[model samples]
Target: MRFIIQRDHLVQSVQDVMKAVTSRTTIPILTGIKIVATEEGVTLTGSDSDISIESFIPKEEDDKEIVEIKQPGAIVLQARFFSEMVKKLPSDFVEIEVQNHLQTVIRSGNSEFDLIGLDAEEYPQLPQIEEENVFRIPTDLLKAMIRQTSFAVSTSETRPILTGVNWKVENNELYCIATDSHRLALRKAKIEMETPANYNVVIPGKSLNELSKILADNNEQIEIVITENQVLFKAKHLLFFSRLLEGNYPDTSRLIPNESKTEIVLHTKEFLHAIDRASLLAREGKNNVVKFSTIGDGVLEISSNTPEVGKVVEELKGVSVDGEELKISFSAKYMMDALKAIEGNEIKILFTGAMRPFVIYPINDDSTLQLILPVRTY
Candidate 1:
């Protein structure tokens, strides 16, 4: 493949594709990034068996020539070296050419380098998705859904299914849920559908995190396609595919309580900051536990104690407090994570009891909810 392309466009596309490339794959070729040059444009792809990302750059966009193709062909280059070389190139444009016997040449301004290239034919074919069961969502909304839930997924491999986020669609609403047994996050959005979509799939949290970073905050609609074991997210000129997690996710409906013994409405940032500060002491504790107690008169006290690190206490005045007085202990880290996921100024917390799980949500919105299991204090 021979092409001269703008360095900026090429750098961005290569970086996006590299998100899927990993050096630890069983297949050696999977470590390289595949580049193909055609009359239309240049395509770059990367895969690590579980996820594949493809980025395309057209020859001309907005009446400007972004790529000039001298020869149409394909090659696989070492991702580590190629990515670094492309970034450090001291020119606005770069020329890449594939010579005889898998030899590759890269040139920019006053610098040039020759590198070994692998046969593109060796790269595995991406799963063929027919785009049959397809749905569309706003790019920003999709990113938010991922951000609000992906963090709560378990990192352990013991329960492989728990390492993925559950996506369920019913009655034109898509609900994203993630939990690590100790804490859970849930977000729901109403989506207009052409036909009823009844897909319940689990996607790895790592895949969703990469997708969220690649997606932009725009009004464009992102097309999603789901097959038996794969899910595709298509946005503009980018395509992302991830393998679906096998096995059914545990039903979490029974975990949310219908009644609460205590309820408090407070500023999100204020509560998060208090927990963050108190966590300094909690770091010295075994469980990193922080305690919250209702002191009446719309006041909530957050405190943490460590025999070695000293004790820290902070009181927060909320908008309102109701129900019975309660004191609960929970993971300081978990509480901070949930608060960061909740994108609102005001937060409403519902506590069932001192020892029971509690649910938190935005006071003005019911679309997202977070639940945390209290830590036992002995």
Candidate 2:
């Protein structure tokens, strides 16, 4: 196998594929990246059983040559060394040649490295998804959905299902919901489906995090294909596959309050800033809890007190404060996370009661919501 590739393109592809490569895989070949050079272009694949990423660099993009293949073949090389070597190569171009017995030579301006390569035949084959269902979403929308919801996935392993984001598609809309029992974030966006799809699948949070990073912020549409046990996301020239979590995700509908006992409309940044400041003191406290209270007419006061440290008092003038006045305490970290996810000038906070869970969402929009369970302060 012999090919000459632009270093810039090769480096970017290597970084994307390396996200799925793990050093501790039980299969020895999984630690290596498989490179296949063909007449059309070059394909780079890396996997660790749970997730796989394939990056393709075309021989010519828009009439510009990115790669030139002398002999079409495939080889698997150690990802750790090969990926680093490409980045540090002395020139803007890279040449790779595989000889008999899997001897590989990588050369650049004034630098030459010889690596022992493995037969690409030993690498596990990427799953060929028949794709009974496929949906298309704008790249920007997909990245926003991931950022808005994936953060709330449970980090605990006690309930393995909560560690994944619940993806649901129905009525031409896609909804992603994630919760760690204490806080939940849900984002919804309209999608066009080739056929109507009603799939409720739980995808591991880790996988979505990697996918979000791989995607660029552009108008390009990403195609999502779902089978029974796996999901594939095709973005630009890359293909990402992840194994779906096995268990059923818990129904989160009942958790969101139907109505609110107290509601407040406040500027998003102002509220976020108050909570961020109040959190400093809360961080020194036992539970990192901050208190919120509605005062006469229009004042909202946020306070945090720690016996060992000090107290913080920050007030914000709300755009409008209505409903029954109430006081509630919740994790400062959770509030900040929720506030960051909401996009807009103003935000609405709905509280069921002092003890019941409350929801934070952008005003005048029903698409995104963040729910938080208040912490008891005794």
Candidate 3:
């Protein structure tokens, strides 16, 4: 295989595909990236069994030649060395050629490198997903959904199911939920689909996080295809696939309380900042716990105490406190995460009781909800 390509386009594609390549794969060829040069364009693929990425660079786009393929062939080269070489090449263009016996050579302005390549036939094939069950979503909205929920996925591997985010689609609405038992983050958005279908799939948090990072903030729409065990995300010339985790995600609908004993409406920024400062002292404490207590008419007190580091007390003014006045303790980290995820300026906190899990969300938006389990503070 031989091809000459533009430097910037190749660099970007390499960086994206490299996200799926792992150095510790049991299959030796998985550490390399498969490059296929055809009459249409040059395709690069990277995979590690759980995830796979394919990037295509067309031979010519908009009358400008991006890739010129002299011979149609395929080769697999070490991702680590090849990506680094291409990025550091001291020119605006790169030329790659694969010779007999899987020997590959890359050349640029005043620099050239040779790498031992493997037969592309040994690389695992990417999962084939049918296009029947496909939908499109704006890139920005998809990224927002991922940011709002992926963080809440359980980091513990003991419950493999909890380490992934649950995605459910029905009636033109898409819902994403993630939980670590102590807290939950949920986001919903309206989407367009060609056919009506219901899908409940659990995708690894790690995979979603990577996908979010790769998706740009442009107004372009991304196509998503869901199959029995794999989900494919296609944006422009890039395609990403991830294997779905098998098992029934725990039913979390019942965990959200139906009633509240106390409710408070506060400015999002003010409350976030107060908790940020309070957490400093709480971090020095045993459990990083912060306490919130409602005072007379529209006043809320935020405090944290540590035996060795003393305590911090701050009053956030001009907040509406309704229902029974109550004090509750919760992880400062959890509260800050929930606050950052909210998009509105004002937020409402609903507490069923001092010990029950409290919910936080925007004042008017019911589509997104964050729940945090209170921490016991003696």
- TM for every model, in the order presented, reads 0.98, 0.99, 0.98
- Clash total of candidate 2: 0
Question: Judged by lDDT against the true structure, how good is candidate 1?
Answer: 0.93
lDDT of 1 by residue, 1-378 (tens): 799999999999999999999999999999999999999999999999999999999999999999999999999999999999999999999999999999999999999999999999999999999966678899999999999999999999999999999999888889999999999999999876777779899999999999988887896899888888999999998999999999999999888888998888888998899999999999987889998898878888899999877998898898989999988899999999999999889998999888889999997899999999998773
Alpha-carbon RMSD, candidate 2: 0.9
Candidate order by lDDT, highest to lowest?
A: 2, 1, 3
Cα deviation at 139, candidate 1, in Å, is: 0.8
How do the residues 291-350 of candidate 2 rate in per-residue lDDT, one tens digit apiece?
999887799889999988889898778898889988889999999999999999999988
> Which residue pairs does candidate 3 place in steric collision?
none
Residue-pair clash count for candidate 1 = 0
Better of 1 and 3 by lDDT: 1
Count of residue pairs whose backbone atoms collide, per candidate: 0, 0, 0
Instruction: In angstroms, give how far residue 362 of model 3 lies from its true place.
Output: 1.0
Give the TM-score ranking, best first: 2, 3, 1
